[model samples]
Every structure is written in C-alpha cells, then in structure tokens.
Target chain A: MKIPTLHIPDGFISAPVSLLFLVISGFFVFLALRGAKKQLDEKVAPLAGLAAVFIFAMQMINFPVAAGTSGHLIGGALAAILIGPWAGVLAVTVVLIVQALVFADGGLTAIGLNVFIMSVLATLGAWYLFRFFQKIFPKNRIGFLTATAIASYLSVPISALGFTFQFALGGTAAITLDKVLIAMVGVHSVIGIGEAIITVLTISAVLSVRKDLVFGASKLKVSLVR
Target chain B: MSTKRIVQIGLVLSLFVAAFVSFYASANPDGLEFVAEQVGFLDTAKDSATGSSPLADYGLTGFEDERLSVGIAGIIGVLLTAVISFGLFTLIKKR
Candidate 1:
C-alpha cells in the first residue's frame, strides 16, 4: 500500500492556491540549498548524488503492502539519514519536480502541494522524530531501525494532515475534512509499514558499508561535521 | 566509493528495479481508485482532457500481448525516470 500521494484532484485547486504552494515549496528549496552549503564537506556531495540516484531507481520498484495496495519508497528517512534534514527535503523535492514535469505521474498545478506535503513536511518531520527516537533506543542497528520505523510511520499522516488542510482550505470536492482526513490517515497507516521496513533495511545496509555517509546514523568522529 | 563500484551498484539496482516492477506490482486498484469507486466518482477518471498522449494507463491499451505492452511501458518509465533524474542532478550540481 503506497502511502497515497497527496495529489490533489485536478480542478480541485485554484490558480492562486496552486501558486501560493509553489512559492512556498520554492522558498524551501532555496533554504535547503543554503543549509547544504553550510553543512557540505567534500564527502557528503558525491554521496548525496549517489543517494539521490539510488532513491530514484528504487521508487520505480514498489512493493505490495496488501492485496491491492502497493507502497513505494518515499525515501525521506533514507535521505535524512544520509544528508541533513534541509538537504533531505531538497533532494525529495527535486525528484518530485522531475516526476511532475517529465513523467506526468503527478499533476502540474497540484505539484506544489505534492512536494510540500510529501517532501518538505515528511522529511523534516521525520528527521525531528528520528532524532528523538535515536536518543532513547540503543546506539546500534536497533536504534537506527526503531527510529526509522517510528519516523516513517509518523511521516505519512503528518503529510496526510498537510494534504487534508489544503483540501479543507481549497478543495473542490464536496467531501468533508473529517472524511478526507480519516481516509488519508487510515490508508496511510497501512502503507507506512512498507516504508518503515524499507527505511530500516536501507539505513542498516548503508551504515554497515559507510557509516561516515549516513548523517543520521548515531555516533561518529568529532571533525566529520564540517 | 570507486567510479567502477558506483557503476556496478547502479547496474545491479536498476536490474533489481526492472525485475520487481515487471513482476511484483499489485494488479488491484490503488487507494485512489478504491476511494473513487466507493464515492461513485470512478467514472470521472476516463480519458484526460489533453487526451492525445501515446502512453496512458501504463500502456495496458487492450494490446494482444498483455505482458509485452506492459513490460515495454514499465521499462520505458524506468528509463525516462533515470534520464530525467540524472539530467536534473547534473544541471543542479553544475550551478
């Protein structure tokens, strides 16, 4: 069960609503670039590129979460795990923009909202929660997996609320906010399992290969941050 | 990682993706489709207004060879995504 994309139905978004979200997402991308520049060491750059390409490749192969539901990698946690939060948001936003413009997988007008909810909100929110969980769990694979799992689960409906509020604010559908929220959150809870497993396994594998590369993976040398 | 290592990783990952998509994807309706059906607006999802596109519905276009048509579409999608992603990254990195 793929965490359903916050793809607003066509005709459901007005020009101004769409424009506002586009601007918000654009501003965040700018912020992320600035953040990356501050955080960038020579090593993080190439790894981020490798990581982005990896995320792009993996997204094409969604796994079945249930009988009819298939879930794909949002890769937000993985992104945050490797890069810092702001950089992670930017990475996912870039992917979404490419998907919108070239693939037509998600709509153009709805693109802004999609990126905002799916990329910015999910990645940043997941990053914060991941850190919180990391503090409590054991400082090893279990810590990483537990944090990734909870963060992945929380992110879906946090992004879901982002979508719901948008719909409540600008929806064309006669559907109520309660109905929308319930449906979005409920379905996403199921989809989140696939995301959690993927995030955990990916983080575990990468950390084993190069713990130096995973920014969110707990404990490393003092001089590495620069 | 070495350049050769990076190439190897990319190749293996892409192959894994191709295999998975061609086989493991769920045949049933997704959440959106389910919601639409439940809400009785499923009919609204007919052809797009800009309906002249060559590839739609992931190319299950009533072709005689179901597997070939779908497999082709899936492969095309992966190629398009990779090319677009690589191009976007290259341009952004240049700046």
Candidate 2:
C-alpha cells in the first residue's frame, strides 16, 4: 500500500498554474514576513516557534474521516487563535517549507500551492472570521471558544475551496470544475468538524492554564456594563 | 503561567505527539487524495523530486521497524521546525 502524502503533489497542477501560485505565494510571504516582524515581540516570538512545532507534529496524526479517507490538522485556525494572525502565517509557512524541503512531505514544485492555501488563505481567513464573530458574541471564554469553533470549522472548507479554484485553473485531469469543487468541499466540510473540535480543545487547554498566552482569548473580557 | 513554562509544555506536547501518538495515525488517504481519486485526478500526481530522501513519506530509510521509522522522523521534524522557526522569529523580532 502506498503511503499518503499531506500536500498537493506535483503534476496535479499545470506548470502555468503552479508558477502563478508561486508568484502569489511569494507576494504573501513578503507581506507575512513584514507583518510578523512588526507583531512579534521577544516574549511572543518563542511561542510562535512552538506553535509551528506543534502544528508540524499534529499534522502527522491523521484521524480517520469518512470511509477510506482520513484528515489531519491544517492548523491555521489553531495557530491564529494561539498566536496573532501574522505570526500564525509565519508559523504555518515554516512548517510547509520544512515539510517540503526536509521531509519531502509536500511536492517541491507544488510548495507554493500548499503554502498559499494552507498558510496564507487559511490563516488569514480564520483570523478575520474569528474576529468578525468575536464582535457579535459576548466578551467571555464561552464566546471566544464559540467563535473559534465556527472559524476553525469553516477554515478547512475555505482552504478546500482554494484548492478547487486552483484545480479549476490548472488541473491536469479531465475532470469538470463543478464536480471537483463539490467533492472537495463536501469531504472537507466533514473534516472541518474534526478541525474545529481539535482547535477548540487545544485553545481551551491553553486558556485553562495561561489565558494571556492565547491571542484570541486575551482580548475577551467579562462585560462590566451589563 | 510563565512564558518559559508555557514553552516547555508546548515542547513536551509536540515531542509526545510526534514521537509516540503519531504511530496510531490512520493509514487512509486524506481528504484531498480521496477527492482526487473520486474525481479521477489521482493519476495526475507525479513522484516528488525529493521522493528518494531518507525521510520521504515520513519514514527513516532502511529502518526495519515502521513505528521507529515514523516516530523518529516525526521527532526530527518537530525539532527541526522548532529550531528554524524559533531562529527566524527571534531574528525578525523587534529590538
């Protein structure tokens, strides 16, 4: 039996599409680097590194999904909730780069695609979505976890949508875009539930111990005006 | 909890997950692979350029024990990621 890889392999996407994503990923990496530079302090820097290590470790554990399929943590939402968004992007990007270069877990040529969807899109999307939900919910631990759960659940499918868009653009196969999109999103939605649970649990664990270290939960305060 | 304590816990957790629990990971194809197979795009994937690396597919080359191979690989991955990311973040951090 062939061992399964966690990232998009080479040749699944056309050269043009891969190149396009590489360029886009480069641009985002530049932005992420700058953003991380501004956001990371001496105290928070090590946590960001720890987050990357944690994400790398977690990605190795693939929980069984539906029949014949398993899913692992994409970790963007988890990272964003633990660290800030910019540092979260940097953390996951480090994991992707190392996985591609060292472990050969992801295709070297397709590194850009993997980073784009899993790091850039998923990280920022989860962060902003969580922030969006945070405003509506009451400022409390329960509210923070609820928003994180929703954001983490949705982040997987959002990244899947990214993959679908890439497939539509440069798929080497003869498959139709609609079919691919539906299948990818349909399966990932189920996967997202697992993502949500893991993310919420991890966040809850951190919050229970050191609430200040959790970037998302740090801002949450019990309403005094109520 | 102090920052050092938190970092220590995170490191311990990562090592534990990578070195031990990773052995129990499911062997099934992941969601993307499943979709690709169903959509008939699975065949489009080519062998990765570094597919011959000792750590390719998260296994140690020439190791007879599957558990040891994957466990060692996971541990190496965790350590390498920790060093590189920590160094990078520290370097980029403001004075």
Candidate 3:
C-alpha cells in the first residue's frame, strides 16, 4: 500500500502562489533567526535541536486517527512550549526541509507553502494561544499541560485552514472552496485530537523531571505539584 | 537532570522512535491526503521532483527489507535533522 503523507506535492498549487509563499516563508525564517538569538540561551539551544530531532522522529509514526485516515505530530505547539516561538518555528521548518529534500515527502516548490502553514502559522499561532490559555488556567502543572493540549489541538485545524486559504488563492484544481474547507477542517479536527495527546504527554514528561527547561514554565509562578 | 542530559536522552529516544518504531506506523493516508482525495483534488497532485532520490519515500535504495529500508532512512533523517538544526541554533543563539 502506498503510504500517504500530509506534505503537499507539486501541481496542486500554481507556481505564482508557491513562489509567493516561498518569499513569505523566507521572511519568517529571517525573523525567527533574529528572535531566536534573543530567546535561545546556552541551555535552550540544544533543546531546540532536540526539538527538531524529536519532531522529525515523531512525524514518522502516523497513528490511525479516523477510518482510513492517519495523522502524525506537527510538533508546533510542543516546540513552542519547550523552546520559544522563534526556535519552534525553525525546528519545524528544518524538519519540513529535510522531509522535502531528502525524503521527497513534500514538493520541492511547495516548501514555502508547507513552511508557512506548519512552521510559521502553526508555531506562532500556537505560542500566542498557549500564553493566553496559561493565563486563564489554574497556573499549575495541570493547567500548563491543559493549555498545551488545547493550543496544540487547535494548531492542527488552524494550519489546515491555512492550507485551505492557500488553496483558495492558488489551487490549480477546479474544486469548490467550501468543499475543501469543510473536508480539510473536518478530518483535521479529528487528527487534532491525536496531536493534543502526543503534545500534552511530551510536555508533561519534560515537566516531570525538568520543569525549568520548559520555556512556558517560566511564566507559571505557581509551585509545581511534584 | 542537567540540560545536556535531557537533550542526550531526548536524542536517543528520537533515534529509537525513528529507526525502529516507525516501521509499524499505519500505512493509511494522512488527514490532508484523505481530505484531498475526498474533496476530489487529489488527482491534481504531482510527483515530487526528487522522487528518484535514494532515500525517497523513506525507503533506502536497493534495499528490499521493508523494516531496514525505513529504519535506515529514519536514522539518516534523524541525524541530518540533528546536525542541521543543532548547528543552526548554535549559530543563532544569543551571544
């Protein structure tokens, strides 16, 4: 059986749209570098690398989420919570690049699209949502993990909407935009559950032994329930 | 645990997952692919330009064993990701 992945292949989107995203993605990458410089200290730098490695590894395991549909970790929220938003973007971007160039999982020309949706939008968007949720939650370990899970869950469908928007703009196929939106969002909502489970579990595991390493933990002033 | 120890252990777990556990991943289409197929635009997708690369599709070239093929590809992917990301982060970290 031919295994299907979420990495967008070529020909589905127009060249102009693809190039547009490429430039957009490049700009975000540049900003990430600048932001990472300030955010990544000596300790966080290695964790950033491990974040990329872990994301790459987890992406390979596509658990069955729905009938005939499997989903793997996007790791955007996990990255942002563990590392900072900027490094999180870079981590996921590096994984997408490797998957495209080496594994040929995604289209070469569509790197920008993939990066924009998964790397930029997912990571940055999740970071903000995480901060917001962390404030409103109980401010304990459970609240932290709960915030992570919610943000991570929403990130999947949010990124899926990003794809839909791009498809509306430059999709080559003669399909209705509404159909794409509903289907993309529907399946992704289910997949988002899987994303939430993996992300919360990973973050919880890290928090267990090394809460200090978690970037998001810095804001939660409450004592951890060790 | 120290940050170095955490990172070291994380890397080992990553390697283990990619190289061994990945072999058992479900073969069904992912959410996006399934949605695309269901929405009727899946036919518009084109093959990747680097489809002929030795490690294309996460399988090693000239390797027939399914387990070893994906496992080796996964290992290579993990290492490559580690090198590139680690180096990049090291360079960009605050001075």
Candidate 4:
C-alpha cells in the first residue's frame, strides 16, 4: 500500500491558482504575525511554541477512520484553544512550512493552497465557532470543552469545503466539483469526529493541569472572576 | 505544576509522540487523499519539488528499517518545529 500524503501534493492544482493562494497566504501570515504580537507575551510565548511542536508531532499519527482511510490532527481548534487564534494561525503555519520545506510532507508548490485551507481557514473557522458556542453555553469547563469539540468537528468539513472550492477553480483533473465536494465532505465528516475527540481530549488534559495557560478556558476564568 | 514544568512536560510528551508512538500510526490514505482517489483526481498528483530530499515522505535516507527512518524523521520534525516556532514567537513577543 502507498503511504498517504498529509496535505495537497504538487500538480494537483494549476500554477496560477496555486500562486494566488500563496499570495493570499502571505497576507494572512503577515496578519497573524501582527495579531500574535499582543498575545505572545513572555508567559505565553513558550507555550505557543510548544503548541506548534505538539501539533507537528500529533499530526504524524494518523488514526484510521474507516476502510482505507485515516485521519490525523489538523490542530487548528486545538491550537486556537491552547494559544489564541492569531498565534494558532502562526503556529500551524509554521508547522506547515516546516513540513513542506524540510520533510516534504506537503507540496512545495502547493504550500499556498495548503496553508490557506488548513491554517487560515481552519484556524479562523474554529476560533469563531468556538466563540459562538461559548456565547450560547454556560461559561464553564464543560461548556468550553463542548465548544472546542463542536468547533473542531465543524472545522474539518469547512476545510474540506475550502479544498473543494480550490479544486473547482484550478483542479488539474476533470472530476466534477459536485463529486469532489461530496466525497471530500463525506469522508472528512467522519475524520472531523476524530478531530473533535482529539481536540477535546488534549484541551481537557491541559485544562486539568493548568487552566491559566489554556486560552479558551482562561477566558471563562476571566468571566467568572468578573 | 508551574508553567515551566508544564511546558517541560509538554515538550517531553511531544518528543515521546514523535520518536516512539509515530511508528504505530495508521498507514491508510488520509481523508483528502482518499477523497481524491474516490473522486478520480488522484492521478493528477505530481511528485513534490523536494521529492528527492533525504527526509522526503517522513523517512530518512540510508536507513533500512522503516520504523527507525520514520521515527528519526519525526523527531527531527519536532525539534525543527519547536526551534523555529519558538524563535518566531519570541521575536514577535512583547518586551
């Protein structure tokens, strides 16, 4: 059996389209760097770095979701909850860049597309969704975990949809967009469940040990203190 | 535990996951790859530009044992990611 590639490979999307995403990804990275400035004080900087390292390591383990398909940690929701959203974006982007350059895990040419979907889209999607959920539910540990789980679950399908949109624009193959959309979303929905479980577990573990360090939980603490 | 100790524990956990547990990870195609195959676009994937790198596909070159090769690669990845990310975060960090 062939080893599964983690992210988009080269030649899957046209060069022009790929380059467009690269430019867009560059913009987001700039925004992330600037946004992370306020969030990355001395206390949080090391934890943010650790979050990136942990994400890189966890992404290596692909748990089987079904026959012939496996899923790994996207680390968007997990990162956002551990660090802030901006740092989460930077952290995951750093991982993706390292994977593409050193490990060749993701395509060098397709780095833009990969980062746009996995880093930008997933990170923002998870962050906002979690916030939305937090607003609706009680501001407790359970509520935070529930929000993280739900947001993590939804982020995968959102990313899948991002891929489908990219493919529709510059796909090298002749496959219909409808088929790609359905299949990508279908498989990733199950994968998202795994993502949710892992995200919840990791968040809970951190929350148990150090509530102050967790970005999501700390917000709740702030509200409770108020 | 203090923040320092917690960070230390997290680092150890990352190292353990990358260097040891990664070998037992599933070998099946990931969601995107599986979807591409099912939807008939799998053939469009070309070899990565860095396909010939020693660490390509998460395996170090010149190692006969697949486990050792991948394990070493994972450890290297973890270290590189930590160093680079820490540097970036520190650089951008507020004084």
Q: Could you give candidate 3's per-residue lDDT for residues A1-226 as a string of tens digits?
A: 2335659998888999999999999999999989988889887789999999999999999989767889989999999999989999999999999999989899999999999999998999999999999889887888888889999999999999999999999999999899999998998899999999999999999899888888889645656684
DockQ, all models: 0.28, 0.78, 0.83, 0.79
Off by over 4 Å in 4: A1-3, A220-226
The model with the greater DockQ, 1 or 3, is 3
Q: Which regions of candidate 2 deviate over 4 angstroms?
A: A1-3, A219-226
Task: Please give the range of 10 consecutive residues that has the lowest summed lDDT in model 4 chain B.
Answer: B1-10
DockQ score of the complex predicted as candidate 3: 0.83
Better of 1 and 2 by DockQ: 2
Model 2 lDDT tens row, A4-105: 698999999998899999999989889988987887777777888899999999999899997889999999999988888888988999999888888877
Ranking by DockQ: 3, 4, 2, 1
| Per-model TM values vs. the true structure | 0.81, 0.96, 0.98, 0.97
Model 1 lDDT per residue over A1-226, tens place: 1223323444554557867888998888888777766664554555555555566556655566554555566777778777677667766776665555544455677778878887788888899998888877776666667887899878876776787677677766576667767776776677777778877787776666666667885333212221
lDDT of each: 0.63, 0.88, 0.91, 0.88
Q: Which numbered prediction scores highest in DockQ against the true structure?
A: 3
- Which residue pairs in candidate 3 have backbone atoms (N, alpha carbon, C) closer than 3 angstroms, thus clashing? none
> Which run of 10 residues does model 1 chain A get worst, by summed lDDT?
A217-226
Q: Write the per-residue lDDT of candidate 4 for residues B1-95, one digit (tens) a residue.
A: 78788879989999999888888888999999898888898899988888888988888899988888888998999999988998998899878
The residue ranges of model 1 lying beyond 4 angstroms of the native Cα positions read A1-9, A65-67, A218-226, B1-7, B19-23, B36-95
Steric clash pairs (candidate 4):
none
Expressed as tens digits, the lDDT of each residue in B61-85 for candidate 1 is 4555655555555555555655654
| Candidate 4: residue A122 Cα off by (Å) | 0.6
